[model samples]
Target: MADKSLNKTELVAKIAASTGQSQATVDAVLGGLFDALAESVGSGTKVSIPGWLSVERTSRAARTGRNPQTGATIQIPAGHSVKVSAGSKLKAAAK
Candidate 1:
């Protein structure tokens, strides 16, 4: 399984084969899906697929950190982050 992960081209090919669609179409749909997710999350909205996954924006407080090389203190700025949670169906599939 370690070496069996699919890249974009391979994933698109498989989906296209299974759905009887062209590889270009599958890739296009995937591109659209990622765009939509980014747009929604960027706007502070939670995007959920009931049985698959959920994505949302989260905040982090600014804090102090050390420089890895210099061992000097530094300030880390607060920022927004994207969080993705796998839903029930995804969990069940993993099990």
Candidate 2:
């Protein structure tokens, strides 16, 4: 069976109706939430939206990597990665 889904337009419409706000306002709010999450992750801070998801920064150790095109060994510098973990409620809903 196909999974049920709602597109951004539908989601914004529903949120606008429920919150008594315009669709533009709903879009702005959603955009703000994503912007905040991104800013938090960029600053190496964890961001959690209750009943939704959590975003955190993780480090990758420096290692040797191979160049696919040239087949040459290369050194990769350690860096930070953004990790996202879904909330328990979201996991339950997926089932």
Clashes of each: 0, 0
How high a TM-score does candidate 2 get?
0.80
Model-by-model lDDT, in order? 0.96, 0.93
Top candidate, metric lDDT: 1
TM-score, per-candidate, Cα-based:
0.92, 0.80
Off-target runs (Cα >4 Å) in candidate 2 are 1-10
- Clashes in model 2: which pairs? none
- For model 1, the run of ten residues with the poorest summed lDDT: 1-10
**Alpha-carbon runs more than 4 Å astray in model 1:** 1-3
Per-residue lDDT of candidate 2, residues 1-95 (tens digit): 55798988899999999999999999999899879988889999998878988999999999999999999999999999999999989989979
lDDT of 2: 0.93
